[model samples]
Target chain A: MIELDVTKSHVLHQWKADSPLIACRFSPTGDHCVSTSQDNRLQRWNIADGQKVVLEGHESWVHALTFNKTGDQLISGGCEGRLIWWSILEAQPKAIRSVEAHAGWIRGVEISPDGGMLVSVGNDQVIRLWKTDTGEKLHEWPAHERHIYSAAFHPDGQHLLTGDLLGKICVWKLSDRTLVRTLDAATLYSPNKGQNAEFGGVRSLAISPNGNEVYAAGTHKGSNPFGAVHEPLLLRFNWADGALTKSHVCDGIPGGLLYRAAALNDATLTAVSGGSSGGILLFFNATQEKEFHRAGLPSLARDMDIHPAKGLVATAHFDQHLRISALFA
Target chain B: MSNRARYACGSMDHALSRRRFLGASGLLGASGILGGVASLPSKVAGAIPKNDYRVVVFNMHGGLSQLESWDPKPSTNTGGPFRAIATSVPGIHISELLPKTAKQMHHLCLLRGVNTAEDDHGKGAYMMLTGRRQTPAAEYPQVGSVAAKMLHDDQTGLPGHIIITPGGGGGRGNEAAYLGPKFNSIHLGGDKPPQNSNKPDAIAQEAEERRHLLRRKINEQYLSQRRSAITDAYTHSYEQALKLMERREVFDVSKEPQAAQDKYGNSELGRQCLVARRLLENGVSFVQITHSNYDTHNDNFNFHIEQVGEFDLAYATFIEDLAERGMLEKTLVVVLSEFGRTPNINLYYGRDHWSKAWSVAMAGAKIVPGAAFGQTNKEGTEVVDGQVDHGDIFHTILRGVGVDSSQSLIVDGRELPIADPAAEPIWKVLV
Candidate 1:
């Protein structure tokens, strides 16, 4: 395995899309990748030859996308609240199963580590669990007062954590479907009274590979919520006690939002931020309060993901492009 | 004809009793009472007109997205996340975010091809409100001020031009320009009454009366030496202030029935709507309620969901109430913004300002109900037919309320067209 090196990272390949890309992910085999965009169709790109295939199903922008552990099937959630299961490996990539999952925009969909269950959260403030293969709902409940933005399952599979616009993290004990505890990441939320608006939220969440800590990323210090004038922030919490461990901040990026983040390893975390000024990729030590490495992108990025095995980073950008960068020279 | 009493009585059951006017002496300044006695218009004795037309303008401050409220382009790349829903008018649909407003579409007329060609916030607002582009050569009056000057009966106690803003401090807005402070908007910022509305305890009613009498004599002496429109406007503003105090109860939304308040909701926009209803019901000729912060450069979709959600409830309720009260026939209601948000969703999922093609909606008075006067392409990027501009909208608004937009107001012996003379009303959408 190649160790990730933030200092030596550089763009390796870039492919243009039909519209601004919302999210992207590498396949488990690391041979191909898929991306969701502002349009209804999803694009699958083969890493080797730059081959692209269109996976069509969603009626609106597909915001949430995830591949099952085996990479045979992919589930996508859209603004129209429809969830679709697609046969990604097939040449045509047909949508195998579709369900009306939520009442509003679906913000996130994550497959549990065991690959049997999928967790979805949406603007309706509800959390739902689904059978990955069948597209059948198992259990669902109103988990937050505000819109839930992201969700993550603990490595042990006993617990699930969800984050919302108010910067609240709820830990649900999966056995009884009960909330065990909540982690406070309030800095990620902003209630702008003058504008009569509430901006910011825990936009992205990730758990360490070893399950020792969890990271939440979003925006804070929003002086003008309507203008989207704010700063990017990343937070870490100790998994055992659920105590806030560190708050990582990037200075001087006014329109910044830590839109997506992923734990690269047990000790390192990477985040991509999009803003009025531009987009930035930042790397931080899990326990440290400062980001040690940073790189500016050509334009604003909406999402980012790590390679399944190789030291490569994939980012979906507003420039209507999907970028792949090698983390080591 | 009972002088201006028909207009003054409005829809209120309560009469403007002479005793009540005399008893409300301390609430106004001694000078205001004196000015009312000196400069009261001679036309106060004229017969009240049968059609006491009025206007209510909803300035959706910042830029409201045309796609989100009035003309949604669903399934298109620029349509954002919202879907289009059917409205009461056949073949008419609006964004799903405004479901309540959609139900009232039969009473509204849509102008989907408004191209103001100005995108800056201040400049855009100027064109929409004054019906003319911003130029250093001349300053024009806002529609509210023009409406007040044209439709208002001088004997009415309430100020003709009134504006309500959230968290706005009560005062006068300097929007009248050459129309003078007399026709300027008396701003009721927040839900509170006009600033310094209540009388101080130190000033006794009887003493205030004596002071008013003495000041009136001095004012007569001073006016005899120097009499001009500027002086008249100064004296008239004082009289307007006195009248405003006499009818200060009209500014209080708390006086509205609990059921009415509940129907309008309890949000700031809700309270402002209630106040607007009260002002209109009490015979104010022109009322402008500003619902703001729509300048969503970032997080446009989420912010609009919240902002337009609030507007949907309050606006629809206000329209329904006006119709129920039979005031809709006499009130020209318009919903306008400085500009519309761009169809292009930016990196922050927000929209920038776009003026090439957007929409504005108006209803009541002479406006043809359930009419869509213009058309945009499938993607809503540009207007394909029946294009109009700020000047056309301004003329249409005046024509709706029976004010001749083509006529010119003689200001200081100079002819100034009420609206832009180069542009005419959208006759296709008017009765």
Candidate 2:
């Protein structure tokens, strides 16, 4: 099990990413990882060996990346809104199929638990589902009034959750593509009073291992036009009831947002957020809605992936630094 | 005093000699105010030959986000969601939010290293406008005022300096401060005969003419006896106003062909750009248009898409339209703002005020188009080279129009260079 020593959490290793990492995901086995970056490239790394192979194809920032059920292939999307499927089994991963998927930046992608469908969401305010193996577009829907930041498949494999710029989250049944429910994560939208201007969104979504709870993370602040606040936030919700169970706000560091959130085997959450300022990492016990550990990262981390077996975390920072931090020795 | 003064009005054109210009300046006749007038040269008026060099300034009222417009970091943490696209200029790329402007890159020379240290809207605007820090002792005149003072063609029968939709106060730069109101921009647009210029449509033109003749006769008689500077200024203003009334059609863009109007788009900025072109065509020396709400501390990306998108179409169309008319050589178009947003993308997904590294675009005045003169660090956190400030910008724009940027004007007994004494024009961008 990973140790919960926040103070002792030090960077394990670091490398220059050449471009900021846009999104990253750890393989199911937690030994390997895949990441996309602003440089319009995809990369996969063997966490233990620290060996990486660059996969270049996307013409812009690679905004979304995910692994398939059997871990044979990786799916990714980016600024070009193109969905690319990569054969990850190879020493040099290859893009097997490329499909022009969205009209705007693809913000999130998730594969179904059964490995049958892949759900991708983007700034085009769309939620689309495709046949994972065939790269066939099965269903595409305008899911939100604003940019949809993240999408995820429910552990049951029959449901999906989508979060948007306006803090609206939608639950839909994948079987019939019916709208199951609409929930307000309004706390994420930091708005300035009397001004139509707002800065944050529901940028991240993670489901607890038990699948009973969902956590959404983003920026939270009061009335200010400049978006000058450095407050990152996490909100826990009862997935079954669509009720917000707890609002876990970060007081860890000056990082402005919780851009990415992940669920751990220990039933806790690891969150990261950063931009021009440095990144802040926080560990929260979702059920308790409380933070047990926190650490200030060395660079402005844009994305992160966790290797559960190794108790390791890898981050992509704005400084082009790809960092690895170990939770336990 | 200087050969440049003769360029101010045709009174010094080769047809009229220096001695004749002086003789004309000393006397006031119907022809003097009508076709042959030039501002009287003082002992201090130095030899600065003026040609018909016109300039138009688009003051983006709010601090525009540099990343989304000019220096897009695209895909970086600070770049937000916008993409950067290639422009006509071989290697130049700007935010995809400005597609039309991207196509017109060859006409735009970007100053990507503007470091105006002030960030507050009001103070920053003052710095950009006056090219100097705002001092409590006396307000510095703005670029428009200086242009008006140096280049106003008295024979144009219009205000030399003009501002359209100038928002009040704060770097919504008001009229000439220390330079006196004559050199101030005549506020126009929105509703016509702007404020006092309205000679009540209630009166018949002939009747108004009779009343004007009577007033002029009385003013001439009083001035003949009194000989006060204020009276002379008022009489000259009265003459100019009458001349403007006769040439009222100059401000009317409705007469422009529909094809031309459609080319500029149907938006307010479109109409203003079209009107600005006509004004420049009619010999207005300087025109300023302010596009507001660039202050994107919130929803920086979306707002920039809307606002900058609007600007791209109108500005591109305007540049192309002007170039096609062969006006580019004689006119300079400047796109600028107080400062730029920070390289940091704050929690709200908006960029805060960053005076450290920003950008401005200039064309005409023989500026090398498609040229990006400075470099910003990859993350756009700072300028890596060729950093310049507002004073240099002021110097560059004036230099484009043949104005002697090094010449000092006696402002409140202080010799203020036409451009700030601290700045020198960036020669690399100049032709």
Candidate 3:
């Protein structure tokens, strides 16, 4: 566990590598961290000393990396359209399963809480679900017309949520592989009167752990159609009814953006969101339910993962650094 | 008299005896002179057939600079890196960049001193296209919408107004404001003709039969509802769509000789212009075609060259085609840009935005050809003489099409002048 200064946020722990790091995740026990990079390598590191247990065999950039619920298996999906499963033994990090999953780049990969299922979404606009142990094809569904950016298995393991390039968010049923709901949550009205206005697309999506709410962000700048900036839109929706609960424009956020977010904690719920401008792990506490607490970090974070057991936050940043922050009560 | 009877009589009287009644009633015509005057008020309603002519606006979105194209000043510091060539019109010169347009300059009028309020793309587009500032409460309809409202014929069977590739890089400010969606221009998003717009094989064979059936069904529906406005609008749009579908053969450019296509170039912008010509030939009162990607803050020279080359060919071909078809006298072609680029090149060898002084070219209609309307300074930084803004330019275009720019539109419970209330058209350029 690392307790760094809250003020000197610029001090980031760097992970030296030959290629650019794309994704990072922490083990359930918070003892080991896994990183996937463009160099076509997945390195498992000891969280204490940062030593690497390099896993090889992938021929392209590992676009997505995920650890199963039990922390005994690592599943990686890549741009080359292959999904590979690795058995997590210290002596032998052996590939247990590999399959040709998609026609285009696989952008998203998620493992169910029970470790029984694996779900992946790709640029080919299809979402494929698989049985994690047997590599059996569970189902495939047409999710979006364009690229599917992110996908996740709901905590209950019975539903799937996916976001697409056209700013469409869809909820799919696992049993029937049917689209249960679609939300055009990024629809924006023209601020200037008399002009018909529309937004670009959705860039990222995150769901609350309780499955009560989901948030989506839009990709575009000012109200001006000619402006070349990507602004963030936070949409909160009721998961059960598929109704929009609240839509908030996260003010004070800059125009250009690139990053993803995740919900943290279970009881007194809060979320940690960060992006390209800089890593801002904002604490949206709902217990007493005040405003958000702005927690600042050094680099621009790309993707982040939370330790399922200890709530330790591990962030992958564009600065080629992976730093773990331990939350203190 | 019953309200329905009074309305029908008033319409008939207005339609049949307009000139005789206007002559007898004098300037402020009293209501008593009109029949059923007490029961039916003399309200200005429906498409009023004025002496107004039609305007076809070609919106070149990125600022088309004056020095590099229309108002070339070869001897000045801000002049084009190339030379200025003489046009078909004596004493008028344009940049060598526009060879084709130059030859056709005898049929054109250049406004060299146009300026706008904003330099930013969105604001500039809104201001230039709408002739009004952007507001949150009320949308000022585009010029096309206004013209359509004033000139659209209910029996015309085609959309009164049309916009080709209306919105893309710079979102459209080209919508009907308070007039609502019924008057909104049918936005054809791209150059290609609308998909499935042609009449289906079955519909073509049973055209007269279907029309009779539709007329009967509509009369039956109207008998119960007394001609609801929603139903009327729907019927109007449906008939317009059907009419356009039957005329799909007009949009096929392959009918044009290969030499014509070569002259227009095979670019999308060129194709859109060709389509615009077809639309005008088929009786669309107002058509606006937007050409985008003029925001050249980087690689200015290379970008301008490619853009101007395409524009020169397309515009020249459009003018020639219209003239050849004997449609030039009736169709007014206005080439306008939002603003112009800065006089000085930035560190990136690019020019930033500027709205101080620019140029717009017009041809056909009542506009006197081969005339330069205004002038800019030596450095091309400011308007030197006869400065014009959105209001003046709009008034000029309107007047060219015979529209009285002094007219008023009702807005916010008050009367608002149609053109900029303060500016007048450059009458010297109009025949």
Fnat for the candidates in order: 0.41, 0.15, 0.00
Put down candidate 2 lDDT per residue, A10-57, tens digits, no spaces. Answer: 798776666656567778777677776656777787777778789987
DockQ of each: 0.35, 0.11, 0.01
Clashing pairs in 1: B168-B189
Task: Please tell me which predicted candidate would have the highest lDDT against the true structure.
Answer: 1
Model 1 backbone overlap count: 1
What order do candidates take by lDDT, descending? 1, 2, 3
Q: Give the TM-score of candidate 3.
A: 0.49
Can you write out model 1's per-residue Cα lDDT over B182-297, one digit (the tens) per residue?
67677787677999887678999898778878877888898999966556766776767777877889888889889999999878888888888888888889999888667777
lDDT of 3 by residue, A7-99 (tens): 222323456554445678777777788887545677787777877788886755576888788888888887667999888646558888899
Off by over 4 Å in 3: A1-329, B1-47, B50-52, B75-77, B166-174, B199-229, B409-416
Model 2 lDDT, residue A113, Cα: 84
Q: CAPRI verdict on model 3? A: incorrect
Number of clashing pairs per prediction, in order: 1, 6, 5
Q: Which tens-of-lDDT digit does each residue in A11-35 have in candidate 1?
A: 8989998988888988888887899
lDDT of each: 0.84, 0.74, 0.65
Put down candidate 2 lDDT per residue, B139-210, tens digits, no spaces: 566889778777778888877787875321111123455455456566564313345555678998899989
